[model samples]
Every structure is written in C-alpha cells, then in structure tokens.
Target: MSVSSVDDRQRAARLLLRHPLIRSTDEERYRLVRRYSSDLEEWFEINTGWAMHADSEVVRLEREPATVADPTHPFATRRGGAVLSRRRYVLLMLGLSVLERSDSQVALGRLAEQVIAAGTAPEFAAAGFSFDLSTREERSDLVAAVQLLLEWGVLVRVAGDEQDFVHKTGDALYDVSRRVLSQLLVTRRGPSTISAQTLDDRMVAMRDRGAAPTTELRNLRLRHTLTRRLIDDPVLYFADLDDEESAYLRSQRAALCRRITEFTGLVAEIRREGIAMVDLDDDLSDVRMPEKGTEGHVTLLVAEFLARSGVAEHFVASLVAHVRSIAPDFAKYWRASALEADAAADLVATSLGRLSALRLITRTGDIVRVLPALARFALAEPTILGGRKP
Candidate 1:
C-alpha cells in the first residue's frame, strides 16, 4: 500500500475505535468509514474480534468486552456529568424499550407515560422499581436518560425542550432513529435466549455464545480477549489476566502490540505491571488527565501527592483530609465551591475517580491502592543548587 493509503486507513481505524458510531449527520467521518469499510472490517474482525458495519446512513462497530467485571467506566449524563445510578440505568433501559415500539415521532409526555407504565409493571415492581414522574428528581432522571439517547443519535429533538418537560411546564417532541436504535445492543447473542437465572450468568452466556471445545478455539478466545482488553481499556494489567491468558500474552506480546499500534497509531507503554496503549493525540479517550478545570487541577494535585507518598495504599477518608488541608493553597486556582470544608469529599472522589479510571490506582472499598503506572507522576525534590525557582 502507498504511504497515503496507509495513513488514511490508520486514521479511519482510529476514528472507529474512538467513536464506534458515525452517522450520516457526521458526513465526513461517515464517508471515511464507508470508503475503508472492507479493510476496517477484516482488520478488526481478525485482530480484535469486533464486527464493523458500514452503510450509507450509518457506521456501527459492535464491541464486546472480554470481561464485564470492571465498573470504572459508567454511562454519565451530559447535563451534570453524574454517573448513571442503578435506578437511572433501569429507567434508561425502560425508555429504550418503549422507544423500540414507538412511532417515528414521539411526544415527550407520551413517551414518559409509556416508560412509566413499563417501569412500574408488576415484574419491575417486584424488582423495586417505581416511577410515576411525580417528583422533580424522578423527572430529572428520565430527562437524563432521554438526553443520553439524544446524545447517541437514537433520538433527535424535534421542537420542544426537555427541561420544560422536567418542570411540567411543557412537553418535547423527538424523531426516533430506529436504525441507530437497533445498533445499541452489541452482545453476541440475544439476551432473551440466555435463560440464565442470575444477571451474571446471563451476561456470561450472552458473551460466550458459540463456545466450542478445542485447543485452537481456546487460543483464539485468548487472543481476542487480550486484544480487546488492550485496545479498549486504558491499561491492561498482567495481574488481571488468568494463567492461560497471561501465558498467551507473554508469548505473543510483541506481535499483538505491533498489530494494534500499526492499525490505531497508538504507542505501547509496556511496564512490568501492565501495558497501556498511549494515544499521542489524546483524542481517543473519553477520560483525560491534567485537563483544564477545577476537577482536573485537583486530580492532578492528588495524583502528585499519591505518586510521591510512595505508599501502596491509603484510606479514602485520609485523602479527604489531605485535600482539605491543601485546599487553601489551591483556593485561588480552584473554584470557590471546592474550597469549602464539605467539598473535600467531592474533590477527593473526583480525583480518585479520574486516577482509578486511568488505571493508576485501584480502589477496594475504602482503601485505594496506588498502581505502578502512577509513579510517572511523581516529582523530584527541589535542589538549592538552582539559582532561583522559575
């Protein structure tokens, strides 16, 4: 292939890995995805076991995780950026189901009623879900779920504002995109076919469809799992893998990392503890570090402290106190609200959330263990030999 073709293919692959969905509304990206659809499909299928579908209207990449155990990355509402709680997730699913049977154009109030009906069904009630939208908080949760769908392009706002509906002043209208809606579920098998009694079992069954007994199949599974984790996760820790997976990774690390790097333009940072596919442009990740904002500043400071402390673990409450003690130094740079005594908890939580998401730390209950990756953030002590501080 020519140099330009190689660059274009890498760009297209990176776009799909980052966004995963490009609608016709995103004309340029959708066209790029369509142009390289065949190459992208073969590459992803063979390397990551991910399936990509590109059509005139939309391009969707169906991604299945190697494991469903991680909870660091949660679906957050765009409004306040709060992670979706269990209740909100349930509401989101209910709303999606309602939209599946909805007309092309759906009114906010009509959809709300349908979601409420489905949410409050005897089956759902048995699971302790109750929704009448009688309270403002409940209405806000519904709006958050709808807003998530709107962000995903599954619903297009037609005329009204969702906040007006939240306040009970007016309702909104939306044009549903069934094509995009159908692409929401990415499991290998339909969930209804699982017949598993527990959620964990069902999840396993859904992802583990077409399992066969063979050494080759086992090796293929191991390769796909390792590749998927390395590409999708911020860091792939050796400790997180089983013996077989760890062994396979040890034997094929160079080849696997090279293929991923060539395709996505990511540089692999391999350490003894784990490996991280470092994105040079920093555009591939949803969670960014050292960002510009109060939360970002606090997270950076907290990371520096943890990195320098050299302690393997610390209680979260102790970190809250540490933040409180250092709040005065950052009061001028940080938001006024973050300086309050009560704000230390939130600051600490946000900082730890970012650090944890980056795989620099792992939290077990109240204790946070600093990972080896966090050591890079440590700073050297100032030397008096320097004439003056810059």
Candidate 2:
C-alpha cells in the first residue's frame, strides 16, 4: 500500500512514539516496535537502552512518559509536567489579560486602574467612599503585581532619568506583549478527576461515532478560551510586571501562538478527513491526494487579503498583487502553485471542493468567505496576533 494509505491509528501511534517521553517508556516503545518493526526503523532511531528489552514485556504500563523531551539528555526537562501553584496561576491569568488588552507603552497607572476596577472599585463605590491606594503598602502591592508581570516579560519599563522617578507619577506604563499573554491564557487544566474507566468509556464512545478524540478537542477548547480571554481583557502594565517575569511570559505567548496554529490546522484536517498518513513533501511532486483540511488556511489568507481591501472581492487579484508587494512573509505562505497559475480559471473550481469540507471556513467559488467562528480566529487584536472576543 502507498504511504498515504497507512492506517491512521498506526500512524498516530508512530507519531506518539516519536516523542522522547513515550520512547522512554519501555512498554509503549516496545509495543510500537513490535507491531511496526519495519515502520519503526524508518520513523525512529532506537537507542541501545530500548534494544536490551523484549518487545512483549513493554505493553503492560498504564501510563507513558512524555515524548517531547529527550530522556537521555541531562538538561532536557519534561514538558507539561511541572506543577504550578493556584496563586501563580491566577496571576498568570491576570497577566495574560493585561498583555492582550494593552499595546506597547501602556502606563503602569492604567494597569493599576484596571486591577482596581476589576477587583476593588465596585466594593469601594458601594460603600460610598472615595478609595485611594496612595499609601506605601497599597503602592507596594501594585508594584509587586507589576514586578511579577515584568519578570514574566509581558511588560517592559519605559526608560527615563532620575527626574522621571521623583515625579512619582507612577505613570511608568508598560509595553504589553500580546504573545506572552496568549501563552499564559492557554495554560491547561490537568486531567479530570473522572475515573479511568469513565475516561475509557468516553474515548470508546468517540471512536464509535467516528469522531476525533474528545481529549484533543477539550485541549483545543481550553487554549482557544484562553486566547479569547486575553484578547478581551485589559492589559497588565510594566509596573505590574518585573523584568524576568516579563521575559518568561513573552516566551510562553510565542510558544502558545505557534502551537495553537499547528493544532488548529491539524485538528481541522482530522475533523474534515479521516486519519491518513502524512509524508512531508519536499520535492513538490505532483501527487493526486484527496482534498482535505486546507480550507481554514486558504480562507484566512483570502479573508485577510479581502479585509485589507475593504471587503471587496472584485479587487482580489489586485489584493493578491498588493500582498506580494507589501507582505512577503504572508505571500510566501499563500502563493499559488505553478499548476494553479497554469490553470488560473480552474483553480477556484478545484479549491472549492477541498475548502467546503473543513466547515471552519466558507467559500463561494474563488471569493473566500469565513464563518463567524472561523472569523474569530482571524480577528486582529492589537495585543494578540489574531484577536478573539472575551
């Protein structure tokens, strides 16, 4: 059978084993090696450690180590296994909101204002009192919060002299990093308290319905909600975030965006088309593969072009031309194939069939359209790369 015809379950298992964590687990590693020994050699490099164990003895484990990290590397840390305190998690959520809402050069005072608005203002107003946090202790709390944010790299202090300090304006606004917020907001809630049997039942139910796994969807939703929340909330200011924390938060946000996009693309493909083997094509060979899972990417590209062109489809060609001129990075991703250019008139006809299957996007002929849900993914928040509603 062709590589494209490989069983998806087998493929997924192979993919799972590619992870360092999974490979470290003797049972899972051996099971994969046993069932697909030939495929395994092509897909992975087995270590001497794995060579010593018999394949049959490996399948008894209830859990497997994560595959994303290198087990043999001394410095390689396990992914998604670290425990975070509730307080830190709360701060992370708040920080994400701040990053999402504020733009570069946001004032510290503004962040304090938002925090007070969200947490304290209503109580004070109801008591018929003019509440002011001008005291040292109150100011310290604000400082502490901002410092935390800064340390996370979500916010940066504006530079100035000593006079900038004495003015005590506390106006030290921060430049919010949307990427940082996006990452923090997507922090996962651990496995449910549900029993293992119940979980297995749910997985079985999903399989019966020919549905993509529910666990995958749940994780996607969690990330999506976080991204949406960040875009909707007020930004955390520099004074609220310290240097170290600010950097950390920024890295997280970047990672989140990259993962979200990848996951979105992968899930959309799976939902629209059943599992199929993916052989990364580097030679640009002309292969007759089934159309699936590419609609969202295409729609996004077209919609972005249309939106920038004032929502008129008539100017699509001109818009495409303009994108080529002004946004080369975007152009590289959206460029049509040589065959597409050769069959210009037929391109739309060919693409429509594939675009329709994903359901995440809508298209009328060549005029790309996006559904409300898909549109949310494309929304641009000044704070986030693609904005979402709260």
Query: Would you estimate the TM-scores of all the predictions?
Result: 0.93, 0.25
TM-score winner among the candidates?
1
Q: lDDT tens digits, residues 1-390, model 2?
A: 554434533453334333322222345544554565544333222210121111322221111211212112122112322233333333344545555666677766666566555545454456453323566545554555566566545666665322232246535756665444333321122223323355456443332323336765544433433332222111122233446434443545555434323322221111121111222431111222232233334444544544444342343354344433443354454444522433333333333333333232344444555332233234464665566767
Write one digit per residue (lDDT tens) for candidate 1, span 1-390.
Answer: 898988999999988887788899998898888888999999889887889887767899987776788778887765666888888899889889999999999998999899988876787778887888889999998898898889889999999999999999999999999999998899978887878888899888888757658998888878888999888888998998889999999999999999989888999999999999999989887789989999998899889989999899899999999999999987889889998879999988988988988899999889999998999999888667858768
Stretches of candidate 1 off by over 4 Å are: 78-80, 383-390
lDDT of 1 at 105: 96
Best by lDDT: 1
* Pairs clashing within candidate 1: none
